[model samples]
Target: MTELQRKLYRQAFALALITIFYNIAEGMISTYMGFQDETIALFGFGIDSVIETISGIGVAHMILRIQQNPNTPRDAFEIKALKITGFSFYILTAGLVVTSVYNLYSGQKPETTFWGLVIASISIFTMWALIWAKMRVGRALDSKPIIADAGCTRVCLYMSVILLISSLTYEITGLPYIDAVGALALAWFALKEGRECFEKAKSISVCGCSDGCH
Candidate 1:
């Protein structure tokens, strides 16, 4: 492997590790905070993080596999992995949207947890850093795996921004619906990214496209 590829692989692995840690933290925080606030969005955010963590790990695994089998046919595995990653976001977003709308109609107030907000903010900031690093590595290496990993981190950033907006807005406005609105916005973001990723994946010509193509 080239030096650049090696660097990207290392970076991808690190990002995956971070993703797992962040998701675990999110789950704990959300669980603690959700019960206090009676807000499903808070809990949902943690669930979303878990998904992101899994996606990140999956991307990392694919990167390792591709590196080991640099000659492996990239036809179905690559395309399918990308599609699965993209679909994950779609499902997450759709679920959040439904939950947000339901919460709005049900008229439930979000519980205020200053600690939760603080931890979430910190977590989001860290994710942003990781995303920035991933993007740089992805560009330098021209590695699709790295790029896909970056995309996962980017989504985490988006999720964080939405949660930050919703939680802070709630604090200021005393409007619980704002949080739900923020979640809906996040859901839309997930859908958009998912569709785009799927399209990109579909457009790529895989190895073994035809007989002896690889």
Candidate 2:
């Protein structure tokens, strides 16, 4: 592999590992503190993080597959990974929409937590880094799966922004209901992105078509 390819793979691998750890931390926090807040937005955030972690795994798997077979046919494992990741995101988005609707109907209010805020802030920065790095690498290598993976991180970044806004709104208004609304909005965004990814994957016939290697 070229030096650029190796560098890109390493960066993606490292980001994937970081995403795994972040998912674990988020789940722990949700288990301990999520019940206190009725908002359900935090729960959605945690769920989304788990989805992102899985997507990261898909990306890592693709990179590893490529490494194992440097001369592997372009339409082999990489295309499979793209389809898998797209399907995974679609499911994740569906779940988020369901949870969001339920939260909105049930009038769930989320309590403001300092730790949650801190974690969200840290996640925002990490997501920005991941998205930027992935875009650079994906574009360089003409890798569709990697670019789709980067799209997942972009979704995460927007979700973080929604979470931040909702958290701040809760702190200011003490309405609590706004959190659920924020989550619904974020879920819509996820669904949109997820569908786009799915469409891209399904429409493409080959890994290195006009769009690029899958």
Candidate 3:
């Protein structure tokens, strides 16, 4: 391997680690704050972060495998991880849907969505930086896997935006249903991600998180 390729691989691996650790921390903090504040949207978002951590592990393994041999196929561990991630996403979707419905039926409102706003703003900035860096490294190595990882990060970026908008909207208008609405939106994304994970496990060319690399 050339020195440039080695350096690019190191960069890619580092990005994967960053993504994993960041999601862990984000999940912990968001879940804590969400529960404390009784915000359905924030809670669902946090849960999603934790599930993303699982997928991130599989991606990291994928990076290592492809680094060793670009032509190597997906291994058992990666497939298992993908299946686990898929089930987790589906479970989360069902959970969020039920919780959101209960909240709406109960006419419940969050004490504060202040923390959601804060965490989501941070996530947006962080995801954007990761996307840019991953794209740069992926292109440097001419790696489709790395580039596809970047596309998945783009989906996370979209979720962060949704959280930000929902939180901000609720704060501005003091609406009770907005949090539930936001959670339902997240559920939709989770459903999509779940289906895609299984598709990724079965298909060689699928990107894993979102439908396609693009």
lDDT winner:
3
* Candidate 3, superposed: residue stretches over 4 Å from native: 205-214
Local accuracy of candidate 3 as per-residue lDDT tens digits, 1-214: 7888888898899999999999999999999999999998999999999999998998899888877876667777878888999999999999999999999999899999999999999999999999999999988887777888898899999999999999999999998999999999999999999998888787744543321232
- Which residue segments of model 1 deviate by more than 4 Å? 2-8, 75-88, 113-116, 200-214
Compared with the true structure, what per-residue lDDT tens digits does model 2 show for residues 84-193? 65576677567667876776687655656454566678778988987888898778887776787787778788888887777777777877467767777767776776
What TM-score, computed on C-alpha atoms, does each candidate reach? 0.78, 0.77, 0.94
Candidate 3, clashing residue pairs? Answer: none
Please name the candidate that would achieve the greatest TM-score relative to the true structure: 3
C-alpha-based local distance difference test score of model 1: 0.69
Q: What is the C-alpha RMSD of each candidate to the true structure, in Å?
A: 4.0, 3.4, 3.1
lDDT of 2 at 188: 78
The better candidate by TM-score, 2 or 3, is 3
Task: Give per-residue CA lDDT, model 1, range 69-131, as digits (tens).
Answer: 655644566567667768887887878888888889988677674544675688788888887
Q: What is the lDDT of residue 72 in candidate 3?
A: 65
In each prediction, how many residue pairs overlap at the backbone (N, C-alpha, C within less than 3 A)?
A: 1, 5, 0
